[model samples]
Target: MTRHLPSRRQALLAGLALAAAGCAPLPRAGTASASSRQLPQERVRAAAPFPMPDISVPDFSASRRFPITDFGAAQGDQQKTSAAIAQAIAAAHAAGSGVVVVPEGVWPTAKIHLKSNVNLHVAKGATLLFSERPDDYLPAVMTTWEGLECYNYSPLVYAYGCDNVAITGEGTLKAKLDVWKVWYARPKPHMDALVALYHLAAKRVPVEQRQMAVGQANLRPQFVQFNRCRNVLVEDVSIVDSPFWVLHPYLSRDVVIRRVKVRAHGHNNDGVDPEMSQNVLVEDCVFDQGDDAISVKSGRDQDAWRLNVPSRNIIMRNCRVKNGHQLMAIGSELSGGVENVFVDNCHFDNAGSGARSTINNILFVKTNERRGGYVKNIHVSNVSATRIAGGVLSVETDVLYQWRDLVPTYERRLTPIEGLHVSNVKVDEAAFVCRIQGEAEMPVKDVSLRGVTVAKVLEAPVSTVNVQGFVHAA
Candidate 1:
């Protein structure tokens, strides 16, 4: 359904040929615009093989500024800065609409909670360095670990049930990873705690009662999470380090993350994770991540099914990745279905990397039998990469990392993956072109590849176990 004309010349020729054959020419690019902003929503919708909504971000041009320094925040003191930030946020929220400003200096702080119609704007020469102490985020807040919902440590910047929130500026939001670096190691205690949480979620325990900040749970908090919010925008910020996933839009809607730069190399430091969210757009971002550059996820098994909100109408374009496991990954935690995702004009530039640092794949769709979600209408086009360590495309149905031995499967429901199309993807070197290991009962369906050229193949170009309607074109 999705078509990619690699170059302008190709597009022109294709249009001319279609006209000569008396067929309607391809729809011109950028015909439909969203709101007054210049985001190419029309192009995104055109690329998608399904219906996509017009995504828009919060506009704060008329908001007043409430600087943290005005509320007794100093550069060296953490307590004073944290209090000042809270006070500034309160003042801004009370003023109907405002921007809580962190001005030009290194400001140490703890958890920052955003309210509705508030913009947390860090100025050009400023850095909001989050504290490393676990106590700084104490008094557990409602958050998710991996994909399960619980009350845990609050993210560094947390937004809960707020509308029209924006975190925009030309500054940096960094984390002090002294304690989190140690928590990255999944010891026996950590694994046990995860199993306990899994059991709790499977049994449908109250989310408020599932406290995980106690004991050796070590479930590191995310850097920034828009939890249960609407009209979110995070733009032009440089994120350095993170405790977990860098930018997370969780159960939020109408989100836009653009012109941002992230360099986080922690345990599971994905760049931007849009989980259980709809109408999301991530464009013009540069990611140097420890995990996938952009991971599309819904909630986990039982928790996701209870919520029943599928992640859909998402688009990622014009992004660059320096280091990652994959350019984009869909679900190892997707139980609440994911569909209508379009990734275009993205590139992975990992040329000067060591062997262990090369990307594994361009696109990886992974789900196990425990996850009952469905993945469909995934389209990727015009993606180029320097080198891929594994393959260009991979769809593995039995990808349970540690849960296989740690805990028993409470419910067995296989994911239905179908309608995956990739076109005009050029990689310098790769282990293979495609590797699909689908289940016998429910094979992956309707996968097609066109113009997927790899310069060097370290292994077989294509491998499959159980797949239906598979097509490949050089």
Candidate 2:
């Protein structure tokens, strides 16, 4: 059964995080409908079916304890509030406490760095409202993504290379991301002030000379970033209106995310992105995003050439994707390859059209023009989707930069994907055209489809004759 453990530790921690972040005491849990119809009980899957193999992650439960903070009560600009909260967390860590409290209120602000072994909890009715003012998110940090270094907007709640960490609560954490429209990077200033944001990013003396604003990019940033973290838990929070990707667990392991709500329409506003990570679990979450709901990626081309990790052992269940690109997406970043992912009991409806853009692919995996690794061993079942405009299944690769002369040469030592299984998949509307291709040298092998039904059928069908490791191309 899909149980709602609203009062679980994660939720409790979310509530506490909000209080510490400076929100006021919550009135009552909002009664807004869950945004989508509940799927048949039989359709939902359990987390236990796909076991969590051993991975590296510290148990923060045994780390020094920390208390939450309230950002609303602090006076002066958002910098003051953020600084106060930051000090509180740092003090806790120095005292050997790992938890910091986030009190309730409409706490306004910008970039706030996260500490190690700290649990930032948000309470119900508490909202962390980030300011649209450009000067708020200041300074530059040399951060990496799947192992790429490009200057961009910093995450609102930024944490890099921490262990045994978590964020939980039942509250509204708002990032007035659309406010970026105020910058000059955009064409028109519509709902969000992107033009003003461009101006903020346009302070182009260059980081080599400019001190604080070196790493500001034109693209929006992730709201939550766990870069190379271990033993992470992000549970039971209502994360709304993110500026970019909501919950990103990148290059980490033994991560768990449950009962989280992320609603954002900003460019590249993915709900959850696990890049080059291992042993992950995402369950009972609701995603109303502008981009792919949940995406897995490893480095891309030149970036991929260096990273030595692949995403593996990923499990997802009882999750819903409302306005998104793909409910699940493996990527163009397959330079390091992806594998061992199981997704089931998910609902995708009213998707494709959202606040900002439309999605082009669902169940999307790409490795265009460039090749380094393989994507394989995926199992999906009991998924129901409605109102989708993109290709139902697209397994081909693409190259944004056209390189006509570059030959597509593959490798034998690649982590070739095998053992694919899909069943009980139902889609309401699809136009046509579904291509599930493996490398010509490694055309997907060993695929099984049982009790699978699609409302619209494409001319092409997926199948693979299997013996040992089945790698179905569908």
Candidate maximizing TM-score: 1
lDDT of 2 at 1: 15
Please report, as a residue range, the 10-residue window in candidate 2 with the lowest summed lDDT: 33-42
Model 2 Cα lDDT, one tens digit per residue, 1-474: 122233365456445543443322222222211110111111222353455564333334444544333433453357676776677667654554355656666666677667555667666767777776555664544333323433445677776655455677786678775566433243332212322222222332122222323334344556788765555777788887766568878777668888998887766677888888888889899888778888888765444444457888888889987778888888766666788888889987764435543555457766664446778777777887765665555565444342223222332233344555676777766543345556555555555656655676544444222124433333
List the candidate 2 regions with Cα displacement exceeding 4 Å.
Answer: 1-51, 54-76, 133-135, 145-147, 182-217, 351-362, 399-418, 437-442, 458-474
Best by lDDT: 1
User: Backbone clashes per model, in order?
Assistant: 0, 73
lDDT of 2 at 169: 72
What residue runs in model 1 are displaced by over 4 Å at the alpha carbon?
1-47, 351-356
Residue pairs that clash (backbone atoms under 3 angstroms), model 1: none
In model 1, state the lDDT of residue 42: 22
RMSD in Å for model 1: 12.2
Q: What is the lDDT of residue 143 in candidate 1?
A: 90
